[model samples]
Target: MKNRIQKLTAIKNAKKVDAFLITSLASLKYLSGYFFYFEHGLSPFQLLPAALVVGVEQQASLVLADNETQQLAFIDPSISVKTYESYVYQKPIDHTTQFLLQLGEAFKQAGIKSGRLGVELNALPASLAFFLTAQYPAIELVDISAEIAHLRIIKDEDEIASIRRAANLSDIGQAAVLRLAKTGMSELELFNLVRREIEESVGTRVPLMADFVSGTATATGGGLPTSKIINDGDLILTDFTPCLNGYWGDSCSTIVMGTPTMEQRSVFNLVKEALEIGIHSIQPGVQAREVDFAMRQHLQAKGNFGHHGGHGVGVIYHEEPRITPYNTMALQPGMVIALEPAVYSADYGIRLEHLVAVTNDGCEVLTKFNHCFQQGI
Candidate 1:
C-alpha cells in the first residue's frame, strides 16, 4: 500500500495539491488494503468507516471510529491512524466534530494546514462537507476523484494477485455448474447447488452470485432462478460472479442440457471467435476501442452484438476503460478485463466470457475454465 501512496503522489503533483483525502470506498480500499462490509441500510448513519488522508510530505492515515482503532493493528500497522468516538446519546459526544478536529490536526501535523487539498468530492458526505468547509475555511480542497480513478485503472501487483484468487473462485463456480447441472433440476435448485459449491470451495460466505438462466429464461436476459424445472435440450446460462476478498471475478457460460444442434454450435462458435479476436487485440499501447470495434464489427457483420465487448474488472465489477465503441483509452499492462460476446435470439442466448490481463506484448487469460461447448453432461 505504501507503493500505492508513492504512485498517487503524482496525482498531487498533477493537481497541484499538497495533500489528498480519499473518501471513496474503492479508492480507500485500494490504498489501505482493507475491505470491510456493512449491511445495506446500516452504514454511515448507523455505521461508518474512516476516510484515508495522504499528504505528499506525511505518512498516510486512516481516520476511523474509536471502536475500529484496534483494527489498525491488522489493517495496516505501519500507516498512521486517527479515530473519533462512536456517537452516543447519553454520552453526548459530538463524533462528527471530533472526526473533523482530529482530521484537521492530522493535516496540521502534516504541514498541510494551509495548502491546497485534493479530495474525492463526490464521495464526501453532505454533513461532513459542511463541517469540513466551515472548520477549515483556509484549506483549498480540489476534487481529484477522476485522478484517483485513472490511477486505479491499471492495477498493481498485489491487486492482480487478489484478482487472481477471485478469478479462481469464479472458475470453481463454473465447474460446479457443469458438474451439478442436470436435466429436470429446478432452476432454483441449480442456483443453490452452484452457490453451495462456491461457498464450500471459498471456505466462507461471500457476496457472490451465479445467475441461473435456463430454457425460456435464457431469452429474457437472465435473472435469479425460479422453481421452473430445467428440461432436456434446454439452454442454461450461468453468469457467475464471485467476490473473493475485495476483488471481483466474472464468468458467463451458456450450455445445453442435451446434445447441441448445428445452429447452436454455429452461434457458439461465432461468439467464441469474437471473444478470442477481442482478446487477441489486447496489448500494451493499443487503443481500448480497437478491441471493441473489431469484436463489434465482426459480430455486427455476422448477426447482432447487444453488449460491449469487454470491461475493466477490479474492486468494482465495472470500472474504467469499458470496451465500447466510443472508448479510446489505451490498453496498458496490469489492466484486468473481461471480454464477453454473445448472439441473443428469442429461443436462447449464447455468450462466452473470459477474464484476461493486458501484458506488454499481448495479454494473459486469467480465467482457466474451458468455454468450449461440452458434448455431454
Candidate 2:
C-alpha cells in the first residue's frame, strides 16, 4: 500500500497537482487493498461508499461511510480514514451532502485549500464536481482519469494470486458444464447446475459474470441462459467469469455434447491453433496489435472473426493493453490478459479464451481447462 501511495505521489508531482481525489471503486481497491461489495447500493451515481484522498506531502486519507468503518482495521495503518453517516433516522440529510462535506474536510485535513487538484472526471459525479468548485473557488480540478487508469495496468504479486484463485473457480465451472449438461436439458437448467457447483466449491454465494449459450445461440457469439434445449451434437460455448477475493477470472471453451461433425472439429482446431499462436507471441516489449495480427492472419484463410483478440484484466473485467488491429501498446511483465480467438458462422460459432500473464521471455497460461470439441460426453 505504501508503494502504491508513493507512485500516486509521483504522478501528482509530475502533473503538478496539489491532491488527487479517487472515486472509482476499482481504483479504491487497487490503492487501499479494501474490497467493497459492488452489489451494495452505496455508489448510486452521486454517492460513493469510499474515496481515497492523496496529498503531495502528507499520508493518504481514505474517506468512507461510517457503516463501512470496519474495513479500516484490515487496511494499512499508515493511512488515515474519515467517515460519514450511513444510517440516520432524525431529519435525515442526503448521503451526497454528507459525502461532499466529509470530502472537503478530508482535503482540509491534508492542508490542501487552494491549488490544482487531480480528479477522475469520467468517474467523478456531477454533485462532487459542483462541491469542489463551490467550496474552493480558486481550486483547479484537472482531469486525471487516464493517469489513474495507467497505474493499475501492471499487477502486483498479491493481485496475481487473487486472479489465479479466481481462474481456478472458472475451471470448476467449465468442468461442471461437461458433467451436468445433457440433451433435452434447458440452457437455464445447465447454468443453474454450473453456478451451484461453483458456489459450493467456494463455500459462498459468489458474484459471477458469464455467458451460457447453446446450439444456434452460439452463432451470435454468446448470450444469457435461455429455455433453449440442448440437442444431440449441439454446440455449447461456456465462457465462465467468477469473481473470487475481489479479483476476476475469465475463460471460454466450446464443446459438443455428442458427436461433432467434420466442420465443427475443423473450426475448433483452427481456433485452438490461433489461441496458441497468440499466446506464443506474448513477450515483454511486443506490441499488442502484433499478437492480434498473428491470430487474425492465421485465421484469414478461414475468414474474419469478431471481437478483440485479447485484453488486460484485473480489478476491472475489461481494460487497457487491448489486443486489436489498432492498439500499439507494448506488452509488459506482470500484466495479465485474456486471449480469445473465434470464428462465427450462420449456424454456429466457436470461441476459446485463456488467461495468461506476460513474462520476461514469453507468457504463462493461467487458465486450466479442456479446450477440445471432440468430447463424446
Using lDDT, give the best candidate's number: 2
TM for candidate 1 is: 0.91
- Model 2 lDDT per residue over 207-303, tens place: 8888989988899989899999999989999998888756899999998988888988888999999999999999999999999999999888777
- Candidate 2 deviant stretches above 4 angstroms: 1-3, 40-46, 374-377
Find the candidate with the highest TM-score and give its number. 2
lDDT (Cα, tens digit) per residue for candidate 1, span 1-377: 43477777788779888887778778777887656553243445322467777776747777787766555644556568777777755777767777877777677666666578888888887787676677778787789989888888898887888888888887887887788888889988888888887888878787776667898678665788889988988888888777775688888888888788898888888888888899898988888889988887767755665678888999888887798888889899999999888878878888788888888899888889888566343
Clashes of 1: 1
TM-score of 2: 0.94
Residues forming the 10-long window of minimal summed lDDT in candidate 1: 38-47
| Candidate 1 segments whose C-alpha is farther than 4 A from its true place | 38-47, 66-74, 87-98, 375-377
